[model samples]
Target: MSHYDVAVIGSGPAGTMAAYHLAKKGISVVILEKEMLPRYKTCGGGLVYRGRRRMPFDIESVVEREFKQINLYFTGDDKVLTSLRDVPVISMVMRDKFDKLLVEKAKGQGTEVKEGHKLTGITFGAISTLHTNQGDFQAKFIVAADGALSPTAKLAGWKETRKLIPALEYEVEVNAEDFARLSSEVRFDMDSVPHGYAWSFPKKNHLSLGIASTRRKKIDLKIYYKKYLEKLGIKEIIGEKAHGYQIPITPRTDGFHRNNVFLIGDAAGFADAVTAEGISNSLWSGELVAEAIFESGLNPEKAGRLYQQKLEKDLLPELHTSQTAARWFYGYRIIRNMLLKRYGDFAMSLMTDLYIGDRSYPKNLMKTIKGKIMEIKNPLM
Candidate 1:
């Protein structure tokens, strides 16, 4: 069987980033993907500004639309709050094109990308063997970036379930006029996407809309989404078909590594609990794991520990902190509106940074709390 220094399963952000970095380090690497190139994925396709930094270069060429504002719709549309940022802080993208771009970048970096190849089974030995349709291959190290229901994680015997939030999303072609009005702001409807939120992200000639939630288990998403569209005064559906996927609301903290295998991204449950955004986290984790492996001589346990330590110290703590704050957020409308009105653009930008993995909400929350405490201590002054 053919052997490589590293084999990565999945071609999503995590796998692509891992392959790219490993290849850049002069390690032989191969990335296996189950889908054809540029295949559509179920996503809201909103990328916040700070998270965009993980990419080596600007991805504006692949961006579908850019926006400078965020509109928050609370309990009632009458009490809407808006925030505007001077610079474009968000962009709407088509995942098919976006993911394909990164995968191509990996290829350009000399990482072998095998498309349309599904990982069937993995055999563990002195060198782990990955069974794929093209053929069987062996590797000294394996990176499982295969998403939430990862087969690689299972093969590695690292199984940890998480609290999952169901999400239904769609990208639709709309009137140019509507698209123009939508150009600089992302619309959020809290009423319809209860427990989660419904979002409308504008593209050049289309609109991306979707709803998600953890509480609405067993509820009919299509029916709920149709009702949501009605409330928005949208009478028609256009563009691509609606698709649904699960977002792991609570990430697994078990440290995903066993034998010669390592897990990153959704497979490792690194998606942020509040926004369900995983792209940047995936890339960050992938890079860290690759670094750990390279430094540790591919020792699974040491690499896993180092990866987890770095994650907890650098990232997961913030997510865990956000998880607590997100609970307080969905509880009532009054507090939410107050925060929107008081914080305004700053809050929205902060959240954008948080979602994209640039800033930690928990860290900011403490600062806010500290500021308030100091204010109370010197009230008269």
Candidate 2:
């Protein structure tokens, strides 16, 4: 069996990010991908500024579009909430290109990716053996950065405890007339789906349109998507490709690290609770785990503790606060609309602030709501 310090399953953002950093630290790391490189991945492709700022290298080469302002629309509300910034708040990317570029960066740092290596099972020990269709390999640790349907997490002894919601996206090419009318800005229309929202993101040549909901089942995403197209006033379509996927809004309850295996990104359910965005946190978690392992000097127990501590200090708390906010925002629409009517732009802007990383979700959401009702000065901060 080929030996390495760490074996990372799946070459998505989380895995590639970890491999990149670990290799930079002179650690022997190999990424195992079940598929070939530059494969198509289902994603909305919107990278918020908070995530963008953390990139160690400039990503302009792979970026399709960048917007300094974003718009939020409600079903009946005529007034659109707009948040503008001097710097681009969101950058669009096609995952095929983005993932490939990240893989190249990791390769530059001495990371090796063995494509078409589908992991079949794992035999755990001081040195674990990864059983893949291609061959078996031993590693001191394993990083499961594979997406939501991760077999690696299961093989590593994790029970399925992540709250996965549904999402559907279509890479649509509309008539030139319609594209011209719709391609200038990034917008999300709330109330377009029950307990969720629909978004129209402008890419280099087409629109990445999709819908997602916190409600797990009994939701017809296509029906809502059809209605959304009518709402957008599209005259004709030139081409279209639909991709349906899941977004994990809740982290797995059972710890992220076990038996010398570490989980990051969707495998650990690090997507945003309120917005269902995950790229940023996936990158964040991968970086943190790399640091944990490096700092622990390859001690599995020490690495696990350090990783847990890193998550608890920031990522876990933010996710918890986002979950509470999502409940109010998506689960209870009446209260949200009422507050929107009163606070108007201020309320939406506050959430956008959370999106742009200017301010974090308040530790005490109930107190914040009460302060708003009491009309306390600066209640809408």
Candidate 3:
């Protein structure tokens, strides 16, 4: 039997970020990854400025491209282009290389990473034992960063309470001319899908094209992907099979920790409801858990309480606000279009500010929306 102070399951951004921070703090930590390093992960691979700023170290080596502008398209050719000329709005990177980079950084800081270690079961008590195909390991604390279908949370008797949405992505190889034309900007077509949106993200050699839906009703994502490709005028050029995955739009409200175990990232369902963006929140949540654990002096119970408090104070408020915003943003297309039409620049600027960490969702969002509506209704005022 092997023992460690903390065992981090899943070596994605959340796991590696937690391990990196813990190891840097001189805490004994180990990372268990089911897949080998540099394995491909299905993602749009778009990193907004907020997420890019959260990374402690430089990611220049893996960044495929950066964009300074975003195009928002609506029905009937109504389009708004928002540009931040001086700064990049989003940075792109393939997850395989990016995740490996983070893991390597953690390993450099003395975190032991065990590849091909899949956590099958967990027994909880004062200390928890993790059963894997390779062997058994013991830890005083466990952080489940194992992603959407978290077996760790299930083994601990926690049922999922967050909403999981479907997303489909494709890496399409385009000719040089088309690639060059699209590689400079990011596009979001709001009318491409119902209760969701389609995205065209430019990479170095290909375009990461995808669509996602937040609505509970089942959507044929494959069909939607084909339509999106046709809309982009690239259906004939798409070179690979489409990849699909589920994204959690909300976090578990009941709790994030139970019985000396904690959850972060997709395991905890910490994705942004409005954008389905998980990387920034995942990194932030991982860092927060590490901070909470250290602040608690490694006492698991105290650490769990502290983690919840930190979330309430820092992370949960924004998530709640975003969830409310998403309801209106996606729920009522007429009102959404009205607001966008009247305040397109302001709305886009506010979102851009949020992405760059300059602003947050309004705390009193309903009140804010009411005020905006009044302004639109009485333009003379």
- Per-candidate clashes come to 0, 0, 0
- The whole-model lDDT of each prediction reads 0.76, 0.92, 0.88
In candidate 2, position 271 carries an lDDT of 96
lDDT per residue (tens digit) for residues 82-155 in model 1: 65656566777788888888888888888987888888888897698899887888898899998878888887
Instruction: Compute each candidate's TM-score over C-alphas.
Output: 0.89, 0.97, 0.97
Across residues 211-256, which tens digit of lDDT does each residue of candidate 2 receive?
9989988788999999999999986989999999999999999999
Candidate 1 — what's its lDDT?
0.76
**What value does the lDDT take at residue 234 in candidate 2?**
85
Model 2 TM-score? 0.97
Better-scoring candidate (TM-score), 1 or 3:
3
Q: Locate the minimum summed-lDDT window of 10 residues in model 1.
A: 369-378
Native-to-model Cα distance after best TM-score fit, residue 368 in candidate 2, in Å: 0.2
